[model samples]
Target: MHEVDMTKCLLISLNEWRDRREDTSAMVETVHLDVGRFTCVEPDQLVTTYNAAVQGTWLDGSRLTITEIPFVGRCLICNGTYDPVPENAYRSPCCDNPLEEIVSGRELRIRSIDYRSDAAAALESAPIQRQR
Candidate 1:
């Protein structure tokens, strides 16, 4: 399911960050994910999967923050943009027309990462050098 893919994505991101910093000792505090309404991924399930996948890894004990993007659409008939309510049969509120273009609600990506960079801390503690 999507959980597998989501877990993979998170691992890939963590790996890339480690590679860039060349430090695997840093602890990740939180991972921010931007998910759209149409991605159909349940927040709770995603968290569980991520936690399980990150066990025994550097990302273990890290928190996950999910930001949901609402389902938005554009009505071709009235040229109106609005949030489609599933209870209302996904119709445009302004013109009562079917949504023609999906303006949003299909996104699933990493928004940002919060981590304590070990390299930065080491650099800060190191003595500064001046050149003449």
Candidate 2:
């Protein structure tokens, strides 16, 4: 089975860490996730795999929290929120109004990363550290 690379996800998590521009040996304990309704994530599977992948890394021992965001479309005619569910052999289901639009079904964001990093302390302990 072709799979979404967990390593890619690990990189994304680390990128979140680096973007904070922090430097430390501190630990990360939790990762907040925002998985879209139609994002194709099997929550149970993802959590299990992600937890295993996070081991032996900076994110080791971290827990992944998956938040389910709804899949909704805004109808342009009446500004209505529509949740799409197609049954049987589908042709294409319309909202009966031309204004329906998908908004939240494809979200990809890392809500937050719980970590501790101390740049100043790291600098102070550096070998041949620079002084201003």
Candidate 3:
């Protein structure tokens, strides 16, 4: 089920990128995704699923970069922000209060997309002119 979800997310991101670009000539080079620690999705498994999903597609050779966001919560009593330990256990360091507000750590979305520009590709294929 997790693999399916990851695949779906990748497909959705690719589709969105295509829609925005509207240029079929553009090829994706890298996909940057921000995932929260609380999302419970393993990075390795997600990457594997993404590779499988993009197989034979325009994004086949694209790299997937995941940035993990730590679980952060705000203390209601003292208005202090901190990272929750023990995975989902939110206990305020100040006043020993329960954290009721989540500042972050629930995100799962694409941050940005990198495309293989024509000039960049051309430069790669260009011959090297080394100076003596």
Candidate 4:
């Protein structure tokens, strides 16, 4: 699956980003990603791939949070925006013109990352739970 390749790329990018950071020893806790509906990247599959790939690595146990972005198309002729569903023929609803501009969607990028500088900080930030 292409998700494997995507995961590999993600790892490489994450590593590069970590290397550039001042606290290279920081442990990533979560990665927030924005995935567009039109990008054709299955969030479930990507998450599964990422989980498997990160096992036994520095990123192990890190959570991946995906926010799905809806497909919004803008009509150049009418300057109207619409969501291109199957019933809409992927055209502009205002003028029945072919979608010319994509207002959103088709995005796949890392939005943010949550990390702890050290194990002690991570433990201190953990929620306290009462015993039953």
Best by lDDT: 4
lDDT tens string, model 2, 1-132?
Answer: 111464366558676666666465666677788878667766677777877777687677878787888877676766666776554121124436543467787665678888765665677788994699
Q: What TM-score goes with each of the models?
A: 0.81, 0.69, 0.80, 0.85
Candidate 2 scores a C-alpha RMSD against the true structure in Å of 5.9
Error of 2 at 11 (Å): 3.1
Report lDDT (CA) for all predictions. 0.86, 0.66, 0.82, 0.89
- What tens-digit string does per-residue lDDT give for candidate 1 at 38-82? 888887889889989888987888988899988899999988889
Which residue pairs come into collision in candidate 2? Answer: 76-99
lDDT of 2 at 25: 64
Sort the predicted structures by lDDT, highest score first: 4, 1, 3, 2
Tell me the lDDT of candidate 2: 0.66
Q: Per-residue lDDT for 20-75 in model 4, tens only?
A: 98777889999999999988889999999999999999999998999999999988
Output the worst ten-in-a-row residue range by lDDT, candidate 4: 115-124
- Model 4 misplacement above 4 A: 119-132
Lowest lDDT 10-mer window, candidate 2?
86-95
Q: Which should have the higher lDDT, number 1 or number 4?
A: 4
- Model 1 segments beyond 4 Å from truth? 86-89, 126-132
